[model samples]
Target: MSPDLYTVIKQICEEKQIPEESVVSTVELALAAAYRKDFADKLQNIHVTLDAQTGNFRVFDMKLVLENVSARIKEEALKLARQKKKAALYMPEFHDHDDEKFNADGVDLNDDDKLIEEGKVLLKFNPRTQITISDAKKIYPDIKVGDEYKEELEVPGDFGRMAAQTAKQVIIQRIREAERSIVFNTYKNREGEMVSGVVQRVEGSVVIIDIGRVNAILPYREQMAGDEYRIGGRLKLVIARVEMTPKGPEVIVSRTHRDLVSKLFELEVPELESGTVEIKAVAREAGSRSKIAVVANEENIDPIGSCVGQRGARVNAVIDELHGEKIDIIEWSANDEKFIASALSPAKVDSVEILDRDERRAKVTVKAEQQSLAIGKGGQNVRLAAKLTLWKIDIVQSETNAVIEISDDEPGDDTENVSQ
Candidate 1:
């Protein structure tokens, strides 16, 4: 009996979010495989078609016509016939009678060659697999060689349990393949963007988040150091990358990427979105502190004030999202000396001089008391300042008696004093 495929197609389309045409094609292919396996001969090429609207189905057998059998076709048919002959020769009934003779080897070589010749003749004259021009004319007066003929076959009353199982497996496999394609296209476009999701589960140190239709993985290395990953908690994540794997597409998300701060700022601040204030650069140590440089294109608008918002509300919102990660907003300047001085914020600088223009190196002088603040704890401030300004900074402390020079590469304890 014909199955009600229309309802099944609609259901699959809605559940899988796949196109109706794709589901219909998948069903047709599954039905064709089931029909061929259960009812058709091995050599018969069969096709199955289903009516999408009415749930009717039909099957066809394809046959090739040839003028004279080609050498390749003859060889293939001979090979198949020999395989069958070998199987029949090893049967118990035949083996019992000729066991000794056949086991002796090299006996009646002519008989073997005769058997091969008979098999070739039988295959060459077989009309179902191959037909000659004269034979074709009897069936179709205007038939030509090298043409294909298709014959419709009666639809089977029922496909057995095994065939039903095979069809179901095919449908499932096709659906998985379609799902992979959809997911790949969906997330591939979302790379380098921020998305919101709920924490689905935790596997060891990795956290899985349900971002709408697909799950994204946030590896331990990409997670914020102090953030708690509880199930059902909501998180805003950056889509670091999307990769295709043998199982399916994998989405890699991040919370500690430096760009995450930039994206968050873009989300909160409208001036950055409208391109009034441009973020020149961003330097971050995730879960700790970050420095961002912004320049205002309009003279009346203040870049720092806009990002900071009324009473520090906008920047504070971003800080709250980052779990109290400290952020320093600096005004960008084209002058290397001015920009370098501002990049080291909260630390008063006495002066900044360009040491090497070609090498992009600068010497910054600060008061002796501000040396520790300029260098920061573990030299993080100088490191981020250098990255934000794209310059190598050498901090020189101005004291009453001597000058102490400290390079960012050197440890905080390693300070060299220059005699006046």
Candidate 2:
């Protein structure tokens, strides 16, 4: 009778969230290995069947009967026999003969004559590899060569310590493999989607997040600027990618990704979720500022108004998720000039001229009073606008209908050329 393992199998299935069938199969395989180790030689074809409900198992040894044994089987049997002989020679009982007849190295003068005789019989036929037709008749009266025979073997109620340790290793390996599969399937589907998790711990510059099913890695570069990552703090991040490593599946998540803003908007705005509104592009500096271009597919929908919600409720919620980051929701345009004009928002533009279309350079004319706003603090606004529009922008000041070209090539130093 086998030990009752039904309770242990049930507990493993529940705790690991693995299917009962998978757990049972793993346990069966481990038990088979343990039985082979404890009751049969390595070369024996041993199989074990387990009754999952009762936890009782039976073992069988299968062998093939051949009239003439194959060379491969003959070689393998001889190799096994030699290994067993070498092990037996090292035993104390084998060395118990008179020490006077042996040299200092424990080599007996008479053992040399015995070894010469034993080597000749080393390659003799082994019963485990092949049973003669004459011997098969003793076990089964009608048995013939080329027939397979299976013998049920009696096993001890408990496995030895070594066999038990082998079973434990097999079980642990199977569980790890199952866990890796589960994590890969779970996180692979969630790529490019938002996920909620808690800060589990920090290692060096990487933060490990507990995302319900598995732990995700948030590298230092992916962390939000100036955000505190205290243990147990809740975070909403985007799944940047899912990778399979030798150790296991690794989920790479990001809080600094621009798609994080898009995902947050999807969560906050019904239009985005319903496919009525689509995001064309997003330029973000995480924990600081972001600009998104949106267009409405339905004529009845006002994409900007929908995103802003009634009295800025929707945008505020998204902003709060990002830790008070500034967002500019602008209407996307098919016309490059109109899009560029809209991209430089919160500042009134007099006109926009395409300086070099092939080079993607543009010149914007703003009122002298609005020049500082267009250029923004440390040119951050203009830089973000340029990035969002995918254009090289040069802000020119207009005073008294006269344009003064300002070159932004030298950062932090404004070089102006007067033009009429």
Candidate 3:
């Protein structure tokens, strides 16, 4: 209402990141609601205007220019009085004349006359029902009945301290909701990407992570097995899934996915990321064991050795992030026999017999001393190898006696020259 209104609106627009036009529109709606409570019922055509230069605002009630006003009112009355058609004479009294004003004898006046009188009555108003106008000239000469009024909106005085307090509370609540919604939408589309979040709280096996804006739930199933999350600790996780619910979007992030291992390698192993070396496969038993296979496109570059780095420095950093998880880096090979043998590392394979090429099933025979090493501790090694090669593997000791009845189509080795 005062010059300060412009400043107030502009400041709110900038602070909220809401457009200036939107602030004006919101203020107009609020004024319209106030006017409706204090003024008229035919508010459909009400309009609000704000002066850009001075921030002066005005409310105007508008009505269509009817060719026959009396007829229109009669039509409106009939539409509302349809039930009285059978008893027209006994129907409730309906008047086209105005009801807000009356003569001294209590006879209602015409609509136009009543409007003028009510306007005057409304202008001389109270705190909850009125606004002020300032005129420097007339001893106050700038004032007029229909001219735009001015007032400084003092939140505590104009609205009573309690009402102003309530408004402050409302604004704070709305802001919190807006911030939550912004964060939810921002992270909802981040499926399959890495995110850094702080551990806000841990309940049972679930950790509530605060990702700067909103809290995201990290379920136990999505976390690396046996991973211990402490409050206020920072974590880097990959968004695995997003579920839209009535409240908002629920994002499931993980540190245990096979892709997570690949991503970590991509971050730590520059050779694997640069296309000189490509990651072929990643098999992870999170917090326990992981196997990654890589291939070098350039000659003389050993992909496995490069990823391991000097004295295992490069891969060690990644393994430390997984809470001391063990990592096995192996060379990627297109040859299934070589790949399967490479996957089952720390053990030498005597032979790898491809039993079913279509099924990708193979039997890996290792010497007696290498049997325990080939299978690894509790079979973790062989399991990871199977996953890395994407093959079904059967491990057998080389000395194990077995009889194989080969079909006649299978050729036998020729030893006639050696015998002679």
Candidate 4:
């Protein structure tokens, strides 16, 4: 190999953000595979090492040092080998996990030489890979069982056209595998955090966004109402899930997640990170409205005011990010009654009567004029308040003594309230 080969390997490592050791190991494996593809018939412990400075290859045929093998253990191995043949014809789902670990002949992996079962050592005899301790002492003076014994082999120059193509395919396959691992780990740690992305395209109901290293999928359900996903448009999304699929890493992002509200606040308000003010709970209806409850650790600091910023600059920044969605920032109280009343903001509550403490149900009586405000446009206010407090709320009119209905999920819901 020319010295320029090292320069090419360095360029690949820098571009892919992969470690130098990993890339060099991949090259060595490729060389060993190419040599085996043309010459070797059976599996052998082939180890290939590349010199970084000179770009040279050194090949070795390695064997495991085994103490002994019993005839019973050998019979068990033969039985299992027959079972594998039966599986190829009939049983398809007999094995689920990958056989990569068990295939240690040419594949470099971490495992002991012997298979130990129930305090007994089970050894499978393979003359090609394993050597007996008494026979091994003839070749070497001091060699212990369970240790590896290696003999240097000549590096072959010429493999057929097919074998050379196989080596190229292996390099490409391993590079792709390494990239998938890097992208999956990088975004999995950022779950529930906001990320900046550009709209790549809309595939039916799902919108794909280019987020730095990878593309994130924003499903139709996660997209906010009235939100436009034009191509090349910029967006701020929260990572909801990161999973590996047969193809590659799947990053699911959301605009309608409740955490988006609190995450946005953390960006605009520096106090949230200081331990001075803390956000207690967030209940969001995504595009239309959101309710956030916050508490102050110190008596001198006002949590809601701190979030609202000077003349509402802080909260306004969050609202702009949400595409002008309305926000209700209320002070969190330890008392359930006071907290429940506060959750239904812009609605004056005359009294809060805990109907069933065990059930976490409450009856809130508001002034006759404030009833409409409390119920919002078709009970949206009461519904969001219910979600924020995690309590079932009933809106009652102080004057008419009539109970109003509410729905927890549906918007514009006018269901009747049974509570008195």
Reference-based TM-score of each model: 0.75, 0.70, 0.59, 0.83
- lDDT by residue for model 4 (1-420), tens: 667778988898889988888788777777767766665524345567898667888876666788766555545444443332111110123221112124435432222233433212222454445566876778886999977777677766776798678778877888888889999999999897899899999999999999999999999988998899899999888999999999999999999888888889999998998878888888777788888889988889989999999999999999998999999999888899999899999899999998888877889999989999998885778998887777888889998888975535445211221111
**lDDT (10s digit) by residue, model 2, range 231-335:** 999999989899999989999999988788888999999899998998887877788888888999989889999999999999999999898999998988878
Clashes of 2: 0
lDDT tens string, model 3, 1-420?
A: 467878887777566665566556555545444443334233122345667448565655332121222443334333333322121110013211122222334324245345344432211221121223332123335554444333322121143455345435544554444544655667777777777888888888888888754578888777876577888888778888777666766778888766777777778778867789888777777788888888888999988888888999888878878888898888878788998899899789888889998877788888889888887787778877776776778888778833222221122111010000
Candidate 4: the clashing residue pairs are: 405-415, 405-416, 405-417
Task: Summarize candidate 1's per-residue lDDT along 1-420 as a digit string, tens digits.
Answer: 345768878988999899998888888778877886678654445567789878888886555566655455555554563443111111212211211222223334234344355444333333334456765577677878766555678888899998898789988999889989899889999997999989999999999999988999999989997999888999889898999999899999999877788888999899999989988888788898888999888879999999999999999999999999999999988888999999999899999999899887888898989888998998889877887776788888777524434433443211111110
Q: After superposing candidate 3, which stretches have Cα over 4 Å from the reference?
A: 1-181, 401-420
lDDT values for all models:
0.75, 0.73, 0.61, 0.76
Candidate 1 vs 4: which has more TM-score: 4
Off by over 4 Å in 4: 41-43, 70-123, 405-420
By summed lDDT, the worst window of 10 consecutive residues in model 2 runs over: 85-94
Error of 2 at 68 (Å): 9.7
Candidates sorted on lDDT, descending: 4, 1, 2, 3
TM-score of 2: 0.70
Better of 2 and 4 by TM-score: 4
Off by over 4 Å in 2: 1-4, 45-49, 58-158, 201-208, 243-249, 353-363, 394-420
